[model samples]
Target: MADYDLVIRHGLIVDGTGAPARQGALAVSDGRIVAVGAIDGRGETELDAEGHAVAPGFIDVHTHDDAAVIRDPRVDFKIMQGVTTDVVGNCGAGVAPANDAFRAYYAAGMGPILGESDLPWSTTAEYFAAVEAARPACNVAAYVPHGVLRYNAMGGERRPPGDAELQRMREQLDEGMRAGAIGLSTGLVYAPGAFARTDELVALAKVAASYGGIYGSHIRDESARLLEAVGEAISIGEQAGCGVQISHHKAAGAQYFGMTKQSLPLIAEARARGVDVTIDVYPYVASSSSLAAMFRLGRGAAFETAPAIIASVKYNKERYEGKYVREIAAELDLPIGEAIRKVLQDEENTPSVIMFIMDEADVRRVIADDHAMIGSDGLPSEGKPHPRLYGTMAAVLEKYVREEPLLALEEAVRKMTSLPAGKHRIAGRGILREGWQADLVIFDPATVADVATYAEPRQYSRGIDYVIVNGEVAAEHGRQTGARAGKMLRRGVAT
Candidate 1:
């Protein structure tokens, strides 16, 4: 007879290795998987997974929950969907290493996302300390924002840094890497970062690579110059010798609908050239961003464009929650872009909206790729918010796997688990094996689906029966059990 912490019996284990499922009883003790095969074991607690699929807990490799994790650390919106870990500080925006010197300029780039409160941390160490103080329900990994790193060296300057300034930027990145940040992230379409030249990015990427970190970018464009933007990312990887992850890999705009056909191959060619490259995409056809950015994307023209459907608007929250920009344009008897600008001017806070700009076929092509991984790009703290914040992982299982059979169950699990863990160099996570940490999710594959929609975005996903973080039960039977066993994971450090 063996005494263990917990054992999940009678489940089909997917294992997160892209292998075939098998019946197994997983035993956990002292925060690690002890045994994961047929066994007669007794534990202090036990769960009957019966007909559920047990796999390593999902990792949201791309997320904007950096500050949200501190404000509402329970992170129920993500945990209910089996997301055991969140990679935060994305889109060239982050909270750490920005003291009073860079706070205002950093706040301007973040817009309404940075409300009235002053940013709380001056360094990555302090940021990690705040996360520890919060006791967030899910584990967290931090990234060093390229723009914030630049801002540390040169405040709000759009021009390329001089030789001395460049060295200062590298120093900040090196500091963040040593402070436990896993990698570097950039938002090329946003200010300052958008001003960066290819050489500048490559130089900064080298600093991150020296510490075994990865590089992820919200590329310069997602529409007309989609392939060109992707090429730039590949170029950075080649010149810097770092693993690259393309964030929210999507082809937006009607004219460039199927451009993924070209973009993916360029990434493949880069891989052929020994430049390690991968991509992450959310499971939906719509994308979300600030109203000001939407207006800029529109170039102040027809809001009635085919794919510019609006999913959420915060100015007149009640009436505009579920309506599209085209509908608002018609209602006001004004041009689509004019309507967007007026709405922004009318609101005191910077408003946010969801755009239905992506093609379903494009999404299918990206998800089907062997090297691509899952990233919700979830913005739980943003206005009204897109359903992706709550439904991304669930929607993938329901729509892509069980419904249309676009991918096999084992392969889908791999994209959500081991693939991301491997790309980010997040050690010992993303797989279910002996000696690995006991981070796992058990859910009914048949019943797993997303209930959150554009109209009502804040809702828990269904079918996930049990969630374990650091070997402790964090959620059970579709609800959190008041456990905050999650820890802040740092790059190059063993868990």
Candidate 2:
């Protein structure tokens, strides 16, 4: 019998620690990396990884795949991109701990993003059980979404919660944290959660902090009030005594271009003051969200200057799906704002949109920041969802490391792997070290690229040769092998 379950040989090992690459071999046994940098033992299976960069599998720290894992177990869009772990329940959107009211609310408002209306679990623990039963293609970690708590406690009331309501929300959050959520996530721009004040968030965040969890937020505004939003997110973490993760940090709108110049420094200052704050950035300039919500916030003015594409629409598929807002307005022979209002009114505010809002310079600046990590923030809606869903990790390697060369291959791997794993407290899976879980990816550094485009958003990425999850080859040659070797990761719990 072979000494190990698997061995990968003759590859350049990028250990996910921002270390220099070195030619070596790695060995795995019983789902753990048993050896690295010169494996002499024989194995039951061997892969000749010549001309590839073998590193820890990418960890997607920002995703809304709360329902996708159960609805579609393959999750090829993620694993095919060498993402072995997905952190779900981002932007305060999720399907768990649902009552009938929240269920109905989710079916209507969050279906475009989460893609499922039928929520099978009523508690976070039950939800995790369902994830395990689904046997996903990649591991999953989750956050206790603030929106769910708010809706469960207050039924979309546009005011501060009374003392009783506040206690109810805190109780629900505490239940989720005890069930192993990594942190609390808030989408302050969305309803109910949007109604919540900074003090309200700080109260719930304290519950998560007591469990040693972090606080992640899609802040109140990303356009004109971007600075104030960042300050609020930082303040929540400061008061709650927890780390903060700013989701998809960006300055949206034409006037706010290059705003990260100020925002990034503000984050740095907070860190100097002993507040642990880090931010994640998707590489794309366009952002996806509910069309109605955008119009409600008066963000639709961006469509007047730049293009916005309909990502998913519950009705009027032929008229809207994948078409630009300007194009649709021309078809209707109406003004841009009028067209937006008509669409939301017609679709009942259910259509999702991809807005070209942020500047490329701002995106590049954020991606190049040392303290910043990578997140796709890709909304997995049905029609023409953002290409970042299928292509985020590969796109970073292709654009930042190979094309403009703004980052070295080693540094980029660090951002995707150890940096997020450490920050999110995802134990024992982000690095290829002895005794660590053997979740890894092997790709040709020169040819690794994102093939998925806005027009063809479902295409698999290029140059990801092998994706191993828990010592099993989950995907090979840009295709899923149908291996379900994933686990439901819990906070402070070693996998």
Q: Which candidate has the top score in lDDT? A: 2
Model 2 per-residue lDDT at 47 = 97
Where does candidate 1 stray beyond 4 Å? 106-111, 114-117, 298-302, 307-316, 319-322
Q: What is the C-alpha lDDT of each candidate?
A: 0.84, 0.92
Model 1 has an lDDT value of: 0.84
Model 2 TM-score, all chains together: 0.99
Model 1 agreement with the true structure over 355-440: per-residue lDDT tens digits = 77778999999999999999998776444578888989999999899998899999999999999988887778888898898999
Off by over 4 Å in 2: none
Error of 2 at 273 (Å): 1.4
Clashes of each: 1, 0
